[model samples]
Target: MGMNAASVLNHIINGEPTTPCSSKGATSSQAKALTTTIINHLRLGRLGKAVSVLFSAPVPFPFALYVHLFRICASKKAIVEVRKVESHLVSFAPTPPVFLLNRAIEAYGKCGCLVDARELFDEMPQRDGGSWNAMVTAYSQNGYAGKALGVFSDMHKSGIFAAEVTFASVLASCASILALWLSRQVHALVFKYGFGGNVILGSSLVDVYGKCRRMGDARRMFDEIERPNAVTWNVIIRRYLEMGNGKESVFLFFKMISLNVRPLTFTVSNALVACSSFRGFREVIQIHGLIIKISYEEDEVVSCSLIDVYAKCGDLVCARTIFDLLSPKNLIHWTSMVSGYTLSGKTRLARELFDRMPERSIVSWNAMLAGYAHSSQWDEAMELIILICNDMRNTDRVTVSLILNVSAGLSDLELGKQVHGYMYRHGFYSDLSVANALLDMYGKCGNLRKARAWFYEMRHFRDMVSWNALLSSYARHRMSEEALVIFWEMQQEATPSKFTFATLLAVCANIFAREQGKQIHGFLIRNGYDLDIVIRGALVDMYSKCRCLDYALNVFIGTSVKDVVLWNSLMLGCYYNKQSEAILKLFELMKEDGVKPDSTTFQAVLLACISQGCVKLGGQYFNSLSQDYFIIPQVEHYESMIKLYGLHGFFDELEDFVEKMPFQPTAPMLARVFDSSKEYNNTRLGKWAVRHLSFLKD
Candidate 1:
C-alpha cells in the first residue's frame, strides 16, 4: 500500500510525541508544542490567529493563552478581550501562579482599569510587597489617594517590606491627600527600612512635608541627611516658599549656594514664585543673580517671575527690561510684562506689549483687559472685551472675570449689559465668580437693584470671594445698608474676611453711621481682628467721619503694625474731625519717628491749616512743600492758596504770588482767581483772571 498521510506523519515524528491511537487523550509533549506555537504567534503580533489555533487544539495551553490574550488586550485598549482572560482564570480549578496574577494586575492597571486592578489585588492568594506596591502605585497614579494609603496599610500589616519605589509612591500619595499624620507614619517606616537617606525618597519626603505645610519637618529631614543632592535642597526651598516663609527660603537658598549645591531650573523657578508670593523684589534680584551665575537667569520661567516681581513692585522699567531680554518670549513672559504694566497703570505700554506678543493665551487676553481696567481706560477695555469674545481661546473664566472688572471700572451700564448678555450666552452666568463680577459691575454702574438681584441669585452657591466682591461693590457704591445686610448674611455661612469687614467699615464711613460703625468695631474687637491695619484704618476713618475723635485715636493707637498709608489715613481722620491741632501733632509724631512723610502728608497738613483758618501757617507749610519736599504744587495747591488769601483779605500777596508763578494758569486756576477777586472786589485781580481765563479757553 502507498504511504498513508497519518502513517507518513508518524514515521517522520520519531523524536515527537506518538499519536493517541487507542485513547482520545493528548500527551504533555503535544500540549507543550501547542503552547509554544500559540506563544510564538502572540510574539509575532498575530493575536487573532493565536487565539484561534489555541482554541482549535484538543488540549489547551491555558498559561500561554492567558498571557497572549492579556498582551493583545492591553496593547489594543480592548476591554472585552482583556476580560476574557480574567473570566478564563475563574474557570480554572487549579490556582494560577503568582507571576501570572501580577501580570494580570499590571495589565489591568496599565490599561486604566482600576476596578479590575483592585479586584485582582484583593483576590491574590498570596501577595508580596511588589504586588502591594503595584496596586498602591496604580491607585496613586489614578488619583485615588485614600485607597493607595489603605493598600500601604495592608502592606504593613502583611509585613511586606516597602521598597524604594513603594515609599516614593506612598509619600506622593500622602502629599496628594495632604495627610500629614499618615505621611509622618510613612516617614518613620521609611527610616526603619533604611531608605530614609535615599536621594529620591528623601526628596519626595521633603516635598510631602512641604506640601502638608510642615516646613519645619521638611527642613529637619533635609538637614538630617548628609550631603543632600540638588533635588533635596530644591524641595526644602520650595517648602519654605509654600509655607509663606520666603525670608527663610532665601536663607536656605543662600545656604545651598555656600554648600556648593547648584540649583536646577525648577529650583530657580520656584524661588521666583517665592519672590512673587512675598512681594520681595530684593529677593527676586538675588534670585536673578544666582540664575545668571548658573546660566539659567534667561530661562523663560525665571524671566517671567522676574518680570512679575518688578511689575508688582511698580518697577515697570525693570520689568520691561527683563521682558525685552528674553530670547524667545513665551505666553507667560508676555502675560507677566503686560500685567506689570497694567498694575502700574501704564496702559499704553501694556497695550503695546500686548499687541507685540507672538501668541496670546487666555491669560494674555486677561492681562490686557486688566491693564485697561486698572488704568481707567474703559473704552479700550470694552473694545478688547469685544475682541476677546471674537477670539475662541478667550472664552475662559479668567477672560470673563476680567471683562466684568473692566465694566465695573468704567461704570458703563451699557457695556456691562453687553457683557451680561455675552456671559448668559456662553453659559457662564451661573458661575459664582462670573455672577459676582456681574453684581460688582452693576453696583459700580449705579444699578444697585440689578446688583442685588445677582447677589440674591448667588446665595445658593456662596464662596468667600464672591460674597466679599458683592460687599465691596456695595461699599464702593455707598450702599451701606445693603453692604451691612450682605455682611450679616455672609456671617451665617462663611467666615467674614478682612476684606468683608473692611468693605463694611467703608460703608460705615460713607454714611457716617456711628451706630453701625460701633457695631462693626465691637465685632472686630471681639474676634481679635482689630489689630489688622486695613480694619483699623477703616475704623479710624469711620470714627473720624462721625466726629468721634477719641474712638479714631484709640483705633490708631491699637494698631501694632501701622503702614505709612494707615498713618496718613489717621492724620486725615484728625483733619476730617476738625481736630487741626491733632493733625499737626500726628504729623510731628510721624516725622519724629522717621516715618518720612510723603507729598500727601504735606498736602494734608496744608488742608488742615486752611480748615482751621491758619492762613500764615498754611503759607509756611505750602512753601515747605515746594522747597523741602520738592512737591511742585499743582493747580489744586494754588486754588487752596487763593482760598486762603481771600479768607484773610491778602489780595496784594495773592496778586504778587500769581505774577511770580511760572506755569500758565489752567481754567480752574483762573476760575479760582476770578472767584477770589469777586469776594475781595479787586479790579486788577479781576482783569488778570479774565485775561488768563480767555487764554486758557483759547
Candidate 2:
C-alpha cells in the first residue's frame, strides 16, 4: 500500500476511521493485509506510524494484532504506546480475553511500570499460569526477588501448575536472593513434575546451587544430566573456580573437550583464570597455547585473562607482549595491563601506561590507586585521589578502601577524617567494607576512641574484621585489660580468627601477664590452633616476656617450621629472660638450621652482647649487620650499637661511631650516650654529649 493507504489503515486500526467504508465489516483478508502493513512499518523503525495505525484501527481489532503491538511496545519500552493500546483495548472491549490482558500486563512490567503492571494484574477478572508467571518474572527481573518468591508462593497456593519457564524464573529468583532453602524446595518440585533431566532446568539448578556455595549439590545436578551442554559445563567449571579449586576446573574443561563440547569465550576465559590460580608459568603457558589453538587469543576477554594470568605467574614480559599485540586495545585491555604492572611492583611502568590510556574508566583509576596502596606509596596514592576528585571520576568501595589503607599506613588522621566525611556525604559509609576500613584507619592512626565509636555505630553491620580491627588496636597500644575485655566481648559475639589469638597474646606479652598468657596458650592448644605460625610466634614472645623461659623454649622447639622471624622471637625472649649466652647459642643454631638472620635477629644478639658485656662480639655482630647479612641498620640498630660502646667505656670508639653514623642522632640516642659518659666519669665526653642532646631536644 502507498503512504495514503497506510495512514488510513492506521486511522482505522486506532478506532478513529476517517471513512464509513473503513469501519464497515472489514474482511479477514483486509485485516491480515492491514496487520502485515503495520508490522512492516514497525519493522522499518516507523514506530510512530505503526502506533498510529494500531490506534486508528477499527474497534475490536484482531487479538493477534494487539498481541503483536504489545510485544513491539515492550521491546522498545514504549510505555506511552502501551498505555494507549491498553486504553483502546478497554474502551472497545470492556472485558478483554485473559491472553490479551496478560499481554498488557507483560508490556507494563517490561517497561518498568511495575505499579501499573501489578494494578492490571490485580484487576484481571481471571488469572492463569501465564499471568502469574508474567508477574513473577517481572518482579524477579526488576530486582524484586523477594516479591517474586512471594508471588510464586501465591501461585502455588492458588493451585496453578507452573510451567518450565515458571520454574526457571523461580530458580533465578532463588539465585538472586541466594535462598538455598527455597531453591531446594523448587528442586523437589522440578523432579516431582518430571522436569528432572531437562538440561535447561538442570543447568539453572546447577547455577543456583553454585551461587549458594553448595558445590556438592551443583555437582550432583550436573552428573544427573545425561547430555549436558557447554553452558552447563561452563557453570560447573566457573563454580569450581569460585570455590578456589582451580585444578578441578581445569580438569573439567579437559573433560568437556574430550566430550567434544566446543568451548566458548567464557569457557576459555574461566579456564585461563583457573590456570592463573596455580601461579605457575608452565600451567599458564599451556593455557596460552590452548588459547592459540582455539584461536581465541585475540578475543578481548580471553586475552585479558591471559595477561592477568601471565602477570600473576610472574611473567610480566609475556603479559606486556600480549597487551601490545591487541588489535584495538579497549579500556579493559589497558586496565588489565596496568593492574598487571602494579601487581608485579612496577608502579612506574603502570603509571606510564595509565597516563597513556586515551579513555580512563573507574576500573583503571582504581587499578592505579590500588598499585600505590599495595606498594605503600602513600604520597602517590593521595596525589591520585586528588586527581580523581578534580576529574570528578566516580569512586566506589574499592577506591575508598584503598585510600583508607593509605591513610592508615601514613598515620594521617586529618586525611582519614576528610575521606570519612566524603564517605558520609556520598552515602558510602553504609557499605560494610568502607565502614571496616574506617575503623582500621582510626585505630592505626591512634584514635582508639573514634575507632570504638565507629565500631558501636555499626551495630548489626559489624563483621569479623570489625571486631579484629578494634581488638588489635587495643593489643598494639598495650591496653591489656581493655584488650582482654574486648577479646571476651568478641568471643561472645563472633568466633575468633587466629589473628585474634595472636593479638591477644601480644597484649599478654606487653603487660607481662604470665598467668593470663598461660590461659590464652591453653585455649590455643585446646582449640587446635597451636600450629599456626603467627600464634606460635606470639606464644614464644609472650612466654619470654613474662619470664617463663622454659615454656618459651618448649614452644619454640615444638614448632616444625621455624622461619627467621620465629627464631628472632625466641632469641628476643632469651634476651628478656637474661639468658645472654643462650641468645648466642640460639643464633648459632639458627644459622646452622639455615634460618638466615634478619634485622631483628641482629638487634636481639647485640642486646644480648650488651647484657653480657661481650664488647668484641657486639662490635662483630653490629659490623656484620650490613656486610654479612646485607641487613641495613635502622635507627633502633644504631641505638643498640651506641649502648654497646658506651656501656664498655670505649670513649674513642663511641665518639667515632657517633660522628660516622648513617643518620643524624636523635634525643634518645644522645641521652643514652650522656648517661653512659656520666657513669664512666668522662667529664669532657659527657659535656659534649649534653651539648648535642640539648641541641636535639630543641
The RMSD of every model to the true structure, in order and in angstroms, is 7.8, 5.0
Candidate 1 ranges beyond 4 A from true positions: 1-97, 100-104, 119-127, 153-162, 188-202, 276-286, 310-326, 557-563, 581-589, 596-600, 612-638, 652-679, 683-698
Single out the weakest 10-residue window by summed lDDT for candidate 1.
15-24
List, residue by residue over 1-698, the lDDT tens digit for candidate 2. Answer: 56864574455455433221224555544655666677678758887687777677664566656776888789999999998888878776766788888889889889988998899999888999999999998888888999989999999999999999989989999998899999999999999988997898999999999999999999999999999999999999999999999999998988998898888889888998998888656767776787788789889889999899889988899999999999899999999999999998899999999999999888898999999999999899989988988875588898888889989989999989999998999999999999999999999999999999999999788988899999988877777799999988888789888888888888998999999999988887788764677888989999999999899989988889899889999998888888888999999999999988989899999899889989888889999988988888988889988999998998888999999997788888888888998999988888998898778768
Candidate 1 C-alpha lDDT tens digits along 405-519: 8867776688779878988888888887787778778877888788778778787885898788778877776778878887888888899878887887778888888998898
The TM-scores of all predictions, comma-separated, are: 0.78, 0.85
Count of backbone clashes, every candidate in sequence: 0, 12
Worst 10 residues of 2 by lDDT: 14-23
**lDDT measured at residue 130 in model 2 versus the true structure, 0 to 100:** 92
Model 2 scores a C-alpha lDDT of: 0.87
Assess the local accuracy of residue 286 in candidate 2 as a C-alpha lDDT between 0 and 100. Answer: 74
lDDT of 1: 0.77
Model 1 deviation from native, Cα RMSD in Å: 7.8
- Flag regions of model 2 displaced more than 4 Å: 1-37, 60-64, 89-103, 122-128, 157-159, 275-278, 525-531, 588-597, 608-630, 639-698
